[model samples]
Target: MVTLELKGLHRVRSKGRVYWYAWRGGPRVLGEPGTPEFVASYNQAIDSVTTPDNSRFRSLVALYKASPDYKKLAHSTRRNWGPWLDRIADHFGELRIAQFDRPERIRPIIRQWRAKYAEKPRTADYGMQVLSRVLSYAVDPLGKIASNPCEGIKQIYNHSDNDRSEIIWTDGDIAHLKKTCSVEIAHAIDLAAHTGLRAGDLLRLSWSHVGEDAIVIPTGKSGRRREAIIPLYQELRDVLARIPKRSPVILTHSKKGPWAPGSLTKAFDTAKEEAWSKGDNLHFHDLRGTAATKFYLAGLTAREIAEIMAWEENTVERIIRRYVGRGAAIKEKIRRLNEVRSRT
Candidate 1:
């Protein structure tokens, strides 16, 4: 008989035959000793065993962080996830993955986090989403848990409740913003209003992206490598012509080469405060919605707007419905009817 000394391997005799068990609990059978099959099974079992410390939530998050799926996220998305993941690890690091097999155990923790940021429900919801994704990863390829605990829980944040009607910017508001802000800030507001580019895309825009008639973006928030083309309107072109390109990026600070995201936000907030002192609820992002409304009024189809803005058609339609309303469509129909009557 060959004496085999493997940590998880056990020798058992049954029905006048000798068998090797991979683990004592599950008792998965390895092949007979000294056989090629037995060696391969033993090696696989050894590799599959998870140490006590490796089964914790912290360990699972570390595994997810190293995964290709996580690495493939956009730079902004990865940066956003960092703090949320850190908070999740701080709350649930010591807990073993198997402990989250029951949904009841995880619900209270999620609710508590949601309550902590009640005023910012969207942000709270985002944290829950990140945790749910991590748990999903644990259930699948990792096999750490049997199922996702966050599967059936309803999202606590109400999109309609938090939706601010005041985000829509008017022509007067845009003119006021231009007057109050510096030349660089004014150009950013105009570009966002004209092109519907997100603040991140605007900050990352380089002179190399500009073409004779269009600005080509190699990548945006979407994970895919598809390029988005935004035509350069005459107004936007004139703004670009006025500004001298001192650095590689089109948007820059007076002294700093490129505007950092936080700095740009702070500057916009100051300008917004100065522009609209009373009942000012506008945000820098609202300018993108303003541009979407303009596109609809200019007779551009939702599909065309979606391609230029790098948004889904459904999203563009929703923005138009929210901002333009049915009144705009009715007014256009009335004007066309009057024009036809005059022609006849």
Candidate 2:
């Protein structure tokens, strides 16, 4: 007889033969002790009982982080997801997965979160989205939860009928920012307006990416290998030429080597207040839309603009239509009518 020390292994005699079983997970029949089959069955029973415990939300998040899907996310995305995940874990980490099996329980939590962040509906919605994905992962592969509780939860930031919060920067606004802000802030704004790169991408840009005639982006927001090339516009060239390359990065603060996102934002907020008396509801990202409008007005096709901006052609077209299409179309129509009248 082979002695096994595995817990939950019980023996029963049936038909004058020995049978071994693992408790809770049911029977694993090995004919007799000291045989190869018996050893294999014993090992299998041990494996069944030693599965990792992921019965809590916190453990499920740890498993999700280890999953290929999470690992494959862009670095920026993973960085952004950390705080959202931390928030969710802080609030509900100790709760059993079964506690959130119903949508009713999830709805009230979302409502409270929404109310807490009532001023920033977009943030609330994004946090909710992160929580929803975590719950979904728990339900499917982890099988800890019976269902996702976040299903059918309405987003508080859905402003379908209202105008978008992001407004484009005008020529006057640009000029005003350049005049009032520091040289570094002015250059950052000009670069954004000319390049249409996101704040993160702009900050990550290195001197190596800049060439005589163009800027090369090896990796962008998509986290793919696609390279984006933007030609060096004359005005942008002037701005770049004036700044001495202090670090490997093209942009940096005088003291701080590279601008942190929060510091950059706060600096922009102060600059905006000094530049505009009315405090225009413009974000640094709005400079991207401003650049897209400028590109469209300069007669670049949506496909060409898409390549330059590292966006889909459809996205380029939609942004153009939203920002400059109506005005550009009306101006062209009036000019054509005037020419026809003059010829007649």
Candidate 3:
């Protein structure tokens, strides 16, 4: 049996009532009568209110803002997650969280979204992740719904072993782009391909980071300082040498500051469009993939690739094995070249 009192109830100062019931928990209101079943229902409603709903989406946003870790997430990650939450809220409309405990209710909504918008598996997977995070904090303390409803729901992602659509600029492609692309975009592309720096890292690079024989990245994605030695590639050297050193930033449009992330992406987009005709869609990150793949094909070990590219060792191994191949053909070519010339 259980009982609840209502202290804030209308027309009463303080009153209490007892009723038959089970376990007891939740906010106490003196002078109100609540049976165990009623109390459980009320607590469930309150839990629903705390989770992502039409009204509670604002609260959830407030909670995220109030968290000290809000500033710790990467700027790009925060930006991506922000709009994703808005989309999820829009999909749910005014549905309460408790109402979503059943998969049937959620499954229709997901199917509807899939039907309306032909979202690829990768995009759908990202949406699922964002939804899961929103409800992660709303789990019941009694271990009834110990985790969010979205917990452990596997996302179906597309994988391919023979996807040769990667934008690996051949020697000819680079030559054509250099001859045609603008000076600024060309320099950015050169930095991306040769140094294996992310677009963000390149934009944030400073003259102080560039030394005589190498480009030093003071802060990589892993928050480690790494120095990538400049290769003997003449075109790469020419690109860096041509850029006038005016500001502290190595790749800056104005002396005030480096290009914003959006601005850089926009510039790269324009240059990429000009560099490739139709049927070739490439993104800036593909440059890193190309460089890493080339290095693996050149017989560099995963550890060596990690040091050069400032990536974790596992990442280097994964990228090489996934994108670049086993390198057996390249190795065979090297072996054949090392052999003595055949006599007539």
- Which structure among the candidates has the greatest TM-score? 1
**lDDT for predicted candidate 1 compared with the true structure:** 0.78
C-alpha local distance difference test of each model: 0.78, 0.76, 0.61
Better of 1 and 2 by lDDT: 1
Model 2 lowest lDDT segment of ten:
158-167
Per-residue lDDT over 277-304 for candidate 2, one digit per residue giving the tens place of the 0 to 100 score: 8887788978887887777767677789
RMSD of 2: 7.7
Alpha carbon deviation, residue 184, candidate 2 (Å): 2.0
Q: Candidate 2: misplaced stretches above 4 Å?
A: 1-60, 74-76, 86-120, 135-152, 160-166, 223-226, 254-261, 313-344
**Backbone clash count, each prediction separately:** 0, 0, 11
RMSD of each: 8.2, 7.7, 9.2
Better of 1 and 2 by TM-score: 1
lDDT of 3 by residue, 14-79 (tens): 357333222234443332345455556555545654565434334454455445445556667777
List model 1 lDDT by residue over 12-78, tens digit each.
Answer: 7799977677867634556777778878887776666543258688888888899987888887789
Ten residues in sequence with the least summed lDDT for candidate 1: 44-53
Instruction: Arrange candidates by lDDT, descending.
Output: 1, 2, 3
